[model samples]
Target: MLMLRLVIASMASSSLSFQEKYDVFLSFRGEDTRNTFASYLYAALSAKQILTFMDHELERGDEISPTLRRAIEESKISAIIFSENYASSTWCLDELVQILECKKTREHIVIPIFYGIDPSVVRKQKGSYGVSFAELEERFRDRMEKVHQWRAALTEASNLCGLDSKDFRPENKLVQKILEDISFKLPKYLSFNEQLKGHLIGIEKHIKEIESRLSISTKDVRIIGIWGMGGTGKTTLASVVFQRLSYFQFEGYYFLWNVREEYSRYGANHLRKKLLSELLNDESILRMDTPFVASPFINDKLRRKKVLIVLDDVDSSTQLEALVEGYYHFALGSRIIVTTRNAQVLKKVADDIYKLDGLNEIESLKLLNLYAFGKSSPPKNYAMLSNNVISYADGNPLALKVLGSFLHSKSTDEWESALNKLKRIPNKDILDVLRISYEGLDKGEQNLFLDIACLINQSFTRDDAEKMLDAGDSFTKIGLTVLIEKSLIECRKDNKLWMHDLLRQVGHTIVCDEHREPGKRSRLWDVKDVCHVLERNMGTAAVEGISFNMSEISKDIKMCHASFSEMYNLRFLKIYCDNIDNKKFKLYLPQG
Candidate 1:
């Protein structure tokens, strides 16, 4: 157990190290396992957002190159795939030597995967290894020391605990087990670049201000609430701060994204379990699931370990109460951050409230110019246009981003048309600013955008979306790319589609304004709205889609033939009930 703790500690230490270039360096014989086992392992690691180094180029000459050796030294863990012909390669043996050398000198971990081969054969230099070494000794009889070093490396690496492909029938299971063990060693980190969209335009000041409010020098527990309207960069600031502080003195860190949505869908118990599991680096906490009910007590372990927790897009105080109980029992030096559109959610719990407003005139201009021209200031010809757009953005970071990106590389005439349309939106609300971008989309893109916004949750997988939209190949081309290009949406890891919270709200608001009556809207998602439309048989031909959960309604209403008679244009629908016993459908079909 002591050695186990030490191993885990070493993993965490290596993971957080700034100098390591990769999570795992994959060393394998290209002729044998590169296409089969090595490819599977590399793909699994990449899917988990693990930075892995795999040499794809063919092995050229006798020994490993300087670049490959450096990769082995730079990686936190070296995963060696020992296949049937692995020892036959002079290059693989040289890589193994460098990998084991790093293991002895640095805080590095070595994982050996014996693929379709016995570890005893590797450790004792028998069978295929013996044949290869006999040939190698004959070829390099003058430099026998190199052969001895190669033998020692293989023997040492084979003794380490690793996955054996034969132990698990159906090789994918072994691949999954290896992935899990690798994850167990490293701390899970959310990539800031993946979330930030790579444009650090006007967020620096917010970062510094929040850092000051955190009072990191003090020993007291701190809860900083960043309250603002949508598209004001609340999530961005929290993410930046979380990334910066995660490497510091904190015992653990967890950033919970889309808090309100998660709470509504999974309940507070889910949040509690997720937080505990993340901070403890143990998924077993999730196995301790109780009844889906609220509770004030988190684990007692949190009281002794200082941690950093960021709850993004929180809408309710109850979510916090159920997760950490307002950090009442937290350890000293722990920091909690809550980003919410509703300030009331954090009012009772936060130590200091940082109300995020719009960027100032200078910051806004710089941000717009940065996105527009790839510099802090625009070209000489576009100064007035730049100023006009930034002033119209009214300091909202989202607006600045979308507008600048939208206007990039366009002709001056196109710029005038774009700015003219933006200026025509009288009120200049952030929503109005966002609407201008939405207005630029064609009819197909617009319909798909609205469908995505009104029908889906904050995050959804591509497969589910493709089925609903019947948008196999063209869905991405017509809608997803356009929205992403305009900075209205993003495709993150795992093919999950996510849009800014404000953009979703804009889509909802637009659908609501399609008609004051719910039945006239193109899509229906809300329980009350769907019920209002269906129960009264108020369905209209205008209703193109409906996503309803019958479990959300307290009582059942008979859905009959008339329920769909009017909805001739209802091409998409998703109506589900949580309880198996609640399924009911009464259709009055025409006589066949």
Candidate 2:
């Protein structure tokens, strides 16, 4: 029994050490190329103890072996080494397909090693992979459909630009370069994940102000409002306060997102249920029907309890009224944090309101430099261009992130072209900054953005999208592959793709602008234009067969339509139509 226990302990230690060290999962067919270039990479990475999982294929089976699938899924990163005749074997093709799917579902980083194969050849499924696939189709003539999916996955994988296995050198310079790239990316990934943790932005000064307001003897339900342009970090600041103060006098905390939308859509019951579930830590609010029924329950639970509640993105006083109902129900020391884009809304809830200004010029430059060139200080040669990019970004965090990621890899000419485009584009509202990310995409990726904007829901899967759009031939054309590369779209565990709300708005605006009338301003929810377009086309059935196409418009043509109505026909349109009244729709199209 003691010997068995020792063996189990030894196994556990080995597993933990293996996880702690490895950074990349290298998937290669041993017969194809692993003995040479891939073997060198494995040795180099392992020497640094940057853990790599290389399946040398000592074992093979008819079905995908369980060990290979687990390694593909579990690894933090997967690099495929595709050589000539790599896709010929069913074994290699299956692994390649699984890796592509894994890219969607998991945070499995994939870097392809194109060994003696062209990227375009991979994308279009020409040359070796295509020839191999053709022969397989003949062999499995009755099972052609199953074979076709494998073809699609192979073509998609080949299309992506991976480090060429031929790019390897015995001098160790290239391997060293690859290691440097991996190291540089690791910190950036960590920083982004940290930013996504949801804290209050620009709240350090506000913390002092809050401190000044508090006194020794008694306390009141202090309402402090943090107001700024959307995405200016108002909610983030309130979150910071909530995290810090909740442990102090506050016994309860509720962090609500999109408070205005929640109240308007679900009404008071939504607020009540959210508060109850959060405080009670239950999935449901038992013994409660209406919000009023649960009010006393909330008041009773929070009576003597000092609660710190953050109501994020509260656009109106109605949301305030629905939430606290006057603040008297809480204990004396309880505090409520309200965040908004409107200063007027702030005045209603806040004993004190803060107007969040843009970051100062120096800070703005610092932020921009960090993003654009991946350095805190601009390089001597690019000082002029660096300053220009920063000046244009306007100290907005969203703008900085957009410009930084877009220009990170481009040359001086690319940066200059981007700057010229920005000049033509008018200064945008906070959400519009994300549109710059779309402009940065290649034309194919822009099409993918259009499809995602018009079609994908919060949890829509890419498999369904590929199937619905018949994306077999044009997967590369749509830029879904590039979108993943740029981190514009994230894949969830269920194989569904998700985008940030800001990114969705950017894509939506791009499509709308492109499709707008030559000289008309695009009002996103314009009822008349919507009804007119639908009626003009004689509804969904008329436009059903025609594929929607949009061309870039000139800057002088400013008043462009930028949104659409959803139709069974114009599947591209996805907007809330309920906001338009029947009278307004009639007014938009008055006729016999």
Candidate 3:
């Protein structure tokens, strides 16, 4: 079985070497260590799906073969196992010389494994090593320079930092150490190309903040949460951080995406099995049509290994219980990064939380220009128009991306028309994501959010909002907190109610969705909509609240009580103007 595996690997390696580089190159004497430590090393590397070149055929030559030398050069790392009689083989010596030459010239990584033989013996040509060199000198007496080169390569290769078999009692322990050292130094950066597809503007600082919270330098297992509103780049930041840092110290890694959707669709049992199968690298589990049954074997296997896991788009407590809470005890130095819009969900599980924000002005502009103008900055003629779109985005990456894509090749007149239309109708893609947090709320919370949204009050205090909406202070405060935690709204330093422009647009879209007609809508905040309802006395019983900045209308416009007669359920009415000239417009109210 072992020989067959090696033959297959050698064939695969030979074919791969034509176009691909090996993750590691293993060099060892076949008779002394091939079936022992060398076999175990190759098995370990192969299990990790790390491509390795191993000479399955017996060594019979005094010089390294062309294919063997090319394999050494193509490999990113070389693991040389110096066992008893390792220096006896000329082929091993030739392989070592080639490995070291590549190391010196290509700056490749070379790992020297002292397999039961002290590194000092290999370094200084002591004991059996000296006898091996003496024999080599006798056999190659005419070519003494070749023997000198072998001695120099051994001394130099043995000086590298690597696993010493003496320290690791059980031979498997040494193999484990070797596998980890090679994995960490593999430099798997290119895989991020598929993970991060779009403009990565403004993500560096976020990645740094998340890494700080992860505490990767420590050995403690930590659950770090990337908490923020939907479409704020939490998932994108997590993906980048996972790709770059996950390979640094982790032994196994699995990135489980759409945890909420998957859990909801497949149930806890299936997700657990999927997690185990992927983390354990067991393909048979997936091949089974039924979900793999849970057992202590799953937990026991995970408990011993250090891994990096990412659970993206986690929304429910059930998902936390099944995926995270079930396997929270990963080995020390293990880290799990979870991305969610709900702070409460993360608060229950995460050891440290990084509150992610959307793009800032400069980043928003750059990202917009990338999608809109296909450059880092907008064309000079479109600078002002570009700023206008950025202002509408207000640092929200989703909105910037959607709006930029929408305005990609449109004319200036189209840009103005689209911006105007956006004020009345939010982008569907951006609105759908923003609505997720809002939809998770209960009926009361939704009503409260809609009321706040219709208020369009950038500075509504908690007390002022409750008094105006008549929702009671206690109810309003709790609803506001929930919105804040979900990141649908924010209570800034001024302690006033605030929300993202896109979120506010979401609220507008929702009310608009309740009814197509302006008068029949549950809330009326748009100046044109309210004016349409008032000027025509089209107010219907569906109207619950109306806010109008009369200063936006003609000074001579007049509103009478009969206009709102049908709006008997209208509980809140706000009509105010910014200037004294606004008071000239007349407003007549019904007598008590």
In model 1, which regions exceed 4 Å deviation?
1-64, 68-198, 292-298, 424-592
Candidate 1: how large is its RMSD? 22.9
Q: Give lDDT tens digits, candidate 2, residues 1-592.
A: 9999999999877654443124577766677767786888788777644668887644777557887777776666667777777767777778877888877854456777676677666667788878988888887899888688887887777666567645666536656656655554443333344333212223356555654553312577777777654445666556555544453234566788778668878787668677757755666574466444545665676676776778877766667867777467777777777876645565655777766555666766666676666556777767899788666655556666666777887888888888887654533554453454465566767766666664566556877666655435766424565565344565678888877544665655654565445113222233444444544532333221112111111111112222122233433333333344543333222222
Question: After superposition, which runs of candidate 3 have C-alpha atoms over 4 Å from their true positions?
Answer: 1-197, 283-294, 470-473, 590-592
For residue 187, what is the lDDT in candidate 2? 36
Off by over 4 Å in 2: 1-203, 210-218, 280-287, 295-297, 426-592
Residue lDDT tens for model 1, 98-154: 888887767578889989899999998899999999999999999999999999999
Listed in order, each prediction's TM-score against the native is 0.45, 0.41, 0.71
Q: Evaluated with lDDT, which candidate comes out highest?
A: 3
Each candidate: what lDDT? 0.77, 0.61, 0.81
Local accuracy of candidate 3 as per-residue lDDT tens digits, 1-592: 9999999999877754443378789998898888877888898888767889999974478678888988998887889989889999998999999888877756578999888788999999988899999898999999999989998999888887877888997777788778767755663323322213344678877777887888888988899888888888888888878866665367789899988789878887777767768778886666667655656876787788899999998887678767876555577888889888888888877898888888889889888887887667777878989999989988888888888888999898899999899887888898888888888899989998898888757867766776677644567767778888888888878778888888888888888888779999999887778878887889999999998776776645456658878999988888877664735765555445
